[model samples]
Each structure stands twice: as structure tokens, then as C-alpha cells.
Target: MITLLLMMGTVSLSVAQVSESTLIRCASTEQDSLRISKNPALFKLRQQSEAVIQQYISRSRVNKRTNADEIVTIPVVVHVIHSEEGRSMGGAGNANITDAQVNSQIEVLNEDYSNTSGYKGFYTDSLGVDTGIRFKLVTIVRTYNSKSQFSPITDGDDLAEISPAWSTNRYLNIWVCRLNDRYLGTSQFPVVTEINNRTQGLATSEDEEQDALTDGVIIDFRYFGRNAEAITSRIYNLGRTTTHEVGHWLGLIHIWGDRNCGTDHCEDTPPAYTKNETTDIECTPVFSDCRGVNTRNMIENYMDYSPDACMSVFTNDQMERMHAVLELSPRRAKLVEFSKITTDELLVDIYPNPVQETLFSSIFTPNFEVFTVSVFNQRGQKVIQDKLNRTSLNVKNLPSGLYFYKVETASKTLTRKFYVR
Candidate 1:
């Protein structure tokens, strides 16, 4: 059983297998309520942050200093938690997502946030602005545990102790696992407030330290990456679940604002009369009005509850809001600044591509003692699998064709495509 303390009231949900047609809860509002309940003072802090963000947005509009040209790269760490049984099953089933699946999600993030996604041309009427934000994988932390399901209500405390968040000031931590209550994902927003009259401005270092421990995104493994084998839902198979959760991590709220005709604080987004229903499968247009002004809902917004196929854009105003949070929030500012650390260290190179015989591999980092290599054919069949105590791999007897290789280390997983002629 999963229970959530929503912003308005308490709600209990009986756990069940989430069908593809069932609605997926973004869970940001429930998460926000829980955080504020833990520290009631956060309520005031969030309000202050919102006010400041609006001011920043206004200033940018007038001065034409939107900072849209300045690209902000966020370093990400994906923590994949799975049980022994799930790991043995493998092949993107449930908790056992492949390394290529993880990287595929990252590629989707880069494309979506940069406005270069393949679906961009589909939403021509209201093509959203590029937020100038890009995500790069810094590390992957894989854990094998006995637990099958982690509680989203508990903020994933069960596995967090084992795979604790890496310095939030530098990396955007994402925990991927099986979630109870059929939730797709959840995220922690940036909320900063002045402590006392003595402090000059912004939140105190003590506040940031406390928030850093829970500062990240949590996703259900089944809905995480863009592999068909991992994601069985045709509506959500494109890996947009993480895209939506990351939007919350960057301080975005639901398009409906968790209320009837409430504002998401973005001027460009049309007022939504209510939350988009999960069964509204065909990207059906919705019309509504706020204060007597007629408007059409932007069900395509990433922050909405619309299906993945229906989601496509983030408005110009939404991009400015995220940029403001990145600039004004101290912890968020530190994230962008500290991400300059060398991410190239995580790169793994596989040599002798299109080879007829032996294939050699080398990792740039010395932290890993051993590596696990798996080769999958174009048909998604694992043809070669081995545990490596050294860097070289022998693929002499494999059938000739295009193949994908996944290299797994203690702290990271790297995937690349190769050809065996």
C-alpha cells in the first residue's frame, strides 16, 4: 500500500501493477507537501522563491537579458537499483535495464531540452523555446538488492542509504528503480530562503546541506529509457518520463498547477481547466477559459499529465523560469558551476570496430577493478557475454553484422555501437 499526503489532503492508494493505459502520477505536488510537512518553514521559502523567479522573468523580458544563449550543462548520475532476480532476467525487463537503455534516455534529454528532438516539427503551431540546457552522464551507480519495490512516498530512503546522492552542487542525481503505487517518477525542487536578518541574502549553507541529501530525481526503471524491450507502453516508449521529472527538478510545476484553472506561472501556456486525464490518448485538443478569457490548453507541455506521444514543448516563459531558478538558487547556481569538472573521464573506448577477429576495450578511469562486457546483435539478442579481468575482448566467431556493446564497471556503464564483419 502507498499513501500520499497531497497539498490539499491525505490520499491512500492500493498498490497494483500500472497498466500502460493507466494514468502516471508525476508526484511533485505530493513530494512538495511531504517536504513542507517535514519542515513547515519551507512553505514560506517556496513562496519567496516563486516571487523572486517572477521578478527575474520580468527583468529578463524588459532588458532582453534572457540568458537563452548561455548554455548550461548539468552533470547527471543515474543510480539503477535492482533485485537479484530482476538482474538475472536481464534484457531491459523491469529493473534490469541495459547500459544502452540508460544512455538512450540521456540522448533524449539532450535532444528535448535543446529543441532538436525528432518530434519538434510535429508541434509547429506552438513550438517551444530551447532552454539552452543539456545533460551529460557523469556516472552510473548500479546496485543489487533484495527489495523489489521502493516507496516514492518515503522519498526512496530504502536504497538512498546504499547509493547516497553524490554532491548535489555538482551532479543531478537520478535514482532508477521499481516504484510502488504505480508512480512513474518524482523530483525535488529548488527552494531557497533567507535565514535571518544577519544573513545577507539567499538560503544559508545549512539549508543547502539539508536539501542536498534529497536533491535529485527518482524514476521507475520500466519507464526510464527509450528501449522497446524496457518500455512496453506504446504511448510512453519514447523515454519522456525522465524528461518530465527533470522539468520538476528544474522548478517547473504541473500545467494545471494541481488545481482547477490554476496557473503554472508561465504566460505562454494556456490555462488548463483541469489536469489532463490519462485516457485522453489521442492528443485531443482541450479548450478552457480563465477569468473570462478563452484559451486552449497546452496538453503538449512536458509538465502536463498528457501521454508521452502528446508531450513536446516547453514555452519561452517556462525556459526563463528554469533559467531564473538556475541563477538565483544558490544550490542550483553551484550545480552549473561545478559541472565543469571533467566528464571525459567516464568515457570508454572500444577498438577494432567492423572487425573480423579480436576486439579490445579501454576505460579512461582507473577506479574500476573489473569490467563486464555484453554484445547484442541488431535483433536485440545477446550473442556474446563475458566478464573481463582485463581490457581485451575476443569476438572472432560471432556472425558478421552491426552489434551493440555494453561495458559495465563498478561505478559506471558505457555503451557503444560497433560492426563485426
Candidate 2:
């Protein structure tokens, strides 16, 4: 049973009934509705974002810009919120989880997004597509809080006040704590206007700052980390809970569409009514639906409300939608851009590594007016030079061999090696 928390001019938030309850897998959709109620403009911004995504999808068919080979790394900031008793890391049943446990969760995220084999996240299903996205742990902040547990609906603002997010536009801030035991996790959807320079310039400063205190993902500490059976539930210890919540963070809806026989906006995934039909705890394959027609429920999809062990894939269309969000959504796009430029090395991901005719680059730097790309042969002789007004560079003239490229920006210059085939 779900209880609603009422607040002035805010949407009601549903809280879990009791401790150790696994009925609620995620609260993102609920949180999103609440956010919309608080700020009606957010809904309009999301619709605008959807329009941009549709345009991106139409263009990607010809350019293949969202290719899986071009990886986008998002920097992560983990805030460990623990009780006074759970002050130290790595004790039996400690809320301040160990570094090893944290790193294990990161490993699971990379494996699941990359579709790495020999892991619980890997699947043999043809619908499964590599997302070409990666997460890097930049910093972990541990705070000792007096509260023993947090409620995703009511206590979210309190938690944020205790340990605030690091620039939401740049880093993916994740809070790990002992939740009310009903939910595994929750996340905030990306807001396009807050990140997009064009729309942001037109909006008031107050409106732009509306969501600053409430961006990123929240996870129950017990359900986090891989092989955490010693402290977590046997049904959810494999670290797939984080995977499912992160899918919501990336703009993918529940595979069941959060309604009766509704659509998840992806045609590849079969229609499912599990969102309203019932909470799914079984791994067995079954045919079910809302209307008279029946279709196999996609229990294997990461966005579904299934047991951790049963979830695996994100379909091709889902992959496209996520990639589009990363590209068109300014906050997400800038997160990738910030990751590339903020480091000491001024890192950039250029692909295909062994280029054929065209070479692509990640958003190299933000606010840099002009930059130059220079290429040299194996003998260190300059072969190609051009001003990079966009993310792609033409290497069709270069012969099939190893080459090196240097990107010069106003702030710094970075050189990396690549190949032409």
C-alpha cells in the first residue's frame, strides 16, 4: 500500500508502507510528476526537448552520429549519507558502505551500459543494444546524518540540504542511504531549458535555479553495490537496482509504459500492462496484456519492474532515445562536454579509432570560440589541418595508416593518437 504526502502547491508523494518491503522498485515517475506540479514550465520544456529529440533521431539515420563506438563518459559524485552508528565504512551492516562496494556498483554500471559479457547485465537477446555510455567516479562525499533512514518523497529535500549536489550540469550526483525499505531508488529527469543556452537566456534567473537543489539519482544503500548479499536482499543484491534507476535518469520510461497496455515509445519492446496489472517478482516468461490481445512481457528489459537477476536488455529504440537525450539535452550534453574538458589532461574521445573516411570527436570544450585540429603521419609530418567548427573531421584524404591528431583550444592543447583504415 502507498501513502501520499501532501504539501502546498506540490504533487502528492507516495511513501512505502513498511521496512523490508520490495513492492516499490523505483519512485522516479512519481518524483517526476511532483516536480512537474511544482513547476508547470518543466512540462513544456520537456515537450520542447522531445521535439528536438525527434529531429535528432531523424538526422542520426543519415549521419550515424549516435554511433555506439563514440563513448560519452559522465563524471559521478557519490554522496554517502549514513547514521551515527554506521559512521565507519565496511562493518557488517554499515550504512557507510566501503570503497570496494562503491567501486563494484560502478563496475556494474559500465558492464550493463556497455553490454559486457560474462556478467549478470549481459544478455543474448537480439534486441539488446550497447548504449556506448560510461560512468567515472570522480569523488565520494560521506556525511554522518542523525536520521537513520530517508524517504524518497518527503525527505529528499532534507537530504539535499545536508549534502548538496555538485554542479548538476557537470556531474551526476548520486545519494546512497538507508531508504524507507520500500523503494530501491529514484532519479530526476534532465531539464532541457536549464541546460540549453538558447532557452536559458530567455528565462528568468529564478526559474533557471528552480531545479538546482533536486537533480541526479537517489539509491537505498542496501540495494547498491554488487554481491552485497551480506547486507542486501538476495533478490536485489546483483546491483541491477541502480541500473534500472539510472535508466530513468537517462530518459527511458518503464517498459510497461506506466499504464494499462500503454506504450513505452519504443516499438521494438512488446506492449506490457505490468505497470498497472501488478508488481512483477517472477523471472518466468509469460504472455500478458491489458486488453484482449496478449504479448510477452519484456521482463529482460532494465526499465521493467522485475527481479534484479531477470533484467538485462535495453532495446535499440531505447538506446536511440537515450543517446538522443545525451546529445540534445543541454545538461546531459554539457555533462559529457564537461567531463572531456575539466580534467587536467583535457581528454577527448575520437572515433572510429581506425577511421575510414570521416572522424568524429566528443564535445571537446565548452565556450571556446575557435579551435584547430592538426593531423600528422607516423613519421610526425603534418598531413591535415582544419578549423573544427563542428564535432566531425574529414580524414578521407589520408591513406590507411597510423596517425596522430592535436586539438588546440584557447585554454589548452591536447594531442592523441588515432588510425586511418
Candidate 3:
């Protein structure tokens, strides 16, 4: 057991595995501890990152800077590391899951994050809400390896090194492979202090390079997609494992804080205890001791260790926390800046492909008068719809992400893509 005195308190992390189909849920906490042990500077970096995140949240709340309606899209790259047996499909133990499984997991992420109605991730709880965050699968790379399973604790860096990442700052890289029976997945938490240091002239070349290499989420192949055929445990075949790990990638800790009756820092998330290595998959209400009072655990929360079927929501505060990370965190913030739309269409010229303050739209040839501009996020949600009486539009409030803008006149309509940084 490795004990570390975190800002919350002294947390002990045990690194061991009993089986692959039960008990152990995720080894993110243990993997984090291991990383910190290898690089002691990470301890201070995480502390600083948390402090900055808290401050950002506080200020945003006070100033009402929350982009509650803006949808931030993230580009994803899935690296499938598997053995020769993985090449075959339609089996209970196949490591290289099919493309359908990979796509199913993507659908699950969108459904859960947006809380699509009638989906498994939808809940009736008042605290549950649509996070307005979506993910786009940019690429999938399958590599055949001799190793059948990788250790979540020790082989994380090795796995990442083998397949490597697709520009960590631009994409959310997920490595899916066979993991030791103990863990379903692990995620590398984002460190913002190192990025902040770049502007403050406190970061070194070594810090930046290291962050680029080991900054992403990792998932066991079996627990990767929705009802993945290879997953032996029906309890976790719903693809929530990937959702849970992605939550960590977006700067969320376990609901229980990886300790007994601990705090996850989100005000809307009630205090709870760890559910690791437990067979309690029931959706029945569970309680934990918080300070002196008995508090009901939010087993339905994605950050909790509840089985895939039982977990369904992300609280409002949790949404804000994730959005804050997307807006301020280093690589996380950049993921939203990539636009899939092509820029070759000829109609009007949009100045400043990446506009931070104002976006100016100049028509090459004015075929008609009285034009209007409409901006839609990557999720096709129209965030800005207004008449373009003037050529310039104020986009200072749009959260950092890729967006499509449409300028419609009396006779013609033009659509193009733009970015907000």
C-alpha cells in the first residue's frame, strides 16, 4: 500500500489484482499514486492544478461565466493494443474488439454526456443534467502485440509508448487492451499547472515533453464498448467504464474520492464511500457516514463504482467542473479547437480562423441585402443565431471549441467553419 498525503488527506492506495471479471473496478487511483511516486513533482503539480481549478470555478460562479448552453466537442483517437488472438472477432475473450463495438461506445458517450432520452444514461433525478459535451472519434489504430495483458500500474507508460498518442493536446487518446484482471481501465489526469507555467516562464522543456507523452485515458479491451462481446462480466459490458475513465480524463475524481466517505469536491455530489471490489451491483439506495450524519450515496453517478446499468448521471456541478476543465486545462482546452468542416468553400471570407474576441464576415460578392449569421457547435446545437446587420459579430462569450457559422441573405446562404480560442 502506498500512502500519500494529498490536499484532501492521507489516502492509501493498494496495488493488487484478484480477478478480471469481478471486484476491482478501475485502477486510476493506484496508477496516479504510482505516477506520483515516480515523479514526485507531480504531487505538487496536482495540488497546484486543483487549487487553480477551484479558483476558476469560484470565479466563474461569481461572475456567471459558466457556458451552460455551449457544447464542447472533443476529438478522440482509440489505440487498440492486442495479441494475435485479438484479430479474431465474435468471442468472449477477443482483445481486438470490432469496429461496431468501438462505434457503440462512442454512441454511449454522446448519449450519456447529453443525457439523451430513453437511453441508459438518462435519469429522472433533479441533479442530473445534460453536460453539453460531445466526442468525435477521429481515428482508430489496432496494433498486434505479444503481451496478452498489460499491468495498469506498471505498464501504462509502456503501453502508451508502444502505440504512442496522436498529438495529446489535439486529441483525447484512449488505449484499449487487455489489462490485468484487477482493473477495467485507467486514465492519466490532466495537469494544468505545467501548462500555466509555459506562459509564466516557469515550465521547462522536459515538463512539456513529458505531459505530451503520458496524458490520456486507458481502457481494458473487454470493458471498452457497449455490450462488448468479449466482456465476460455482464455487469460492466455497457461501456460505462470508458465513460468513467473519460470523466477522469476531464478532471473528475471518484465520487468517493477513493477513500471511505470522502468528498469529490463537487457541491452537488453528496458524500460517499468507496465501492471498489464490491459485488453490490443493485441500484438500491446505499448510505455512508459523512462526518456524523448518514448520507445517501449517489450510486447512479458515473464517477461512482456502481455497475454500468446502475450508473446514469452527471450532476450539474459536475458538468460545470468538466466544462471548466475543457475551457482552462492545457490539452483538454485544445481538443475542442479542431473543426472537421472544410474551409475551401467559396462564398464569404471569415477573418481570424480562430477568433478570441470578434469574428468578421466579409462577403466576396453581395448578391442580396439583410444577411443573418447563425453559429452552431460541433454537436449541431445552434448557440448564436442573430441577424448580421453588420459585418462583425461578437463571439467573446463562445466557449473554446470548433463551430460552424452560416450567413444567410435574401437569396443565398453560406456556411463555413470557425474556431474560438
* Cα RMSD for predicted model 1: 15.4
Model 1 residue 421 distance off true place after TM-score fit, in angstroms: 67
Of the two candidates 1 and 3, the one with more favorable TM-score, higher being better, is 1
Q: How high a TM-score does candidate 2 get? A: 0.72
User: TM-score order of candidates, best first?
Assistant: 1, 3, 2
Q: Which tens-of-lDDT digit does each residue in 258-362 have in candidate 1?
A: 898898898778888887767555787777887798887787888887777777798888898899888777657756655444553455556656666666543
Query: What TM-score fits each model?
Result: 0.73, 0.72, 0.73
List the global CA lDDT of all models.
0.71, 0.70, 0.71
Residue pairs in clash, model 1: none
Q: What C-alpha lDDT does candidate 3 achieve relative to the native structure?
A: 0.71
Residues 314-394, candidate 2, lDDT per residue (tens digit)? 778888888887766656776765656644444455666777766655434444334577888989898986544334556
| Model 3: per-residue Cα lDDT over 1-421, one tens digit each | 3222222111112212244345467788998898788789889878888888888889988998755677777778888887754377545556788888888889989988887624343234667889988888877888877666677777767776678765565567899887764678888877675444232211233444454566788888777887656766767878888999999999898988778877788988888766634455666677788789787777888888888878788988889889877766755664554333334333565656687876655443231234577889999998987653334556889999999988776667788999999
Model 3 residue 166 lDDT score: 58
Residue 12 CA displacement from its true place in model 2, Å: 27
Off by over 4 Å in 3: 1-21, 117-124, 194-204, 339-421
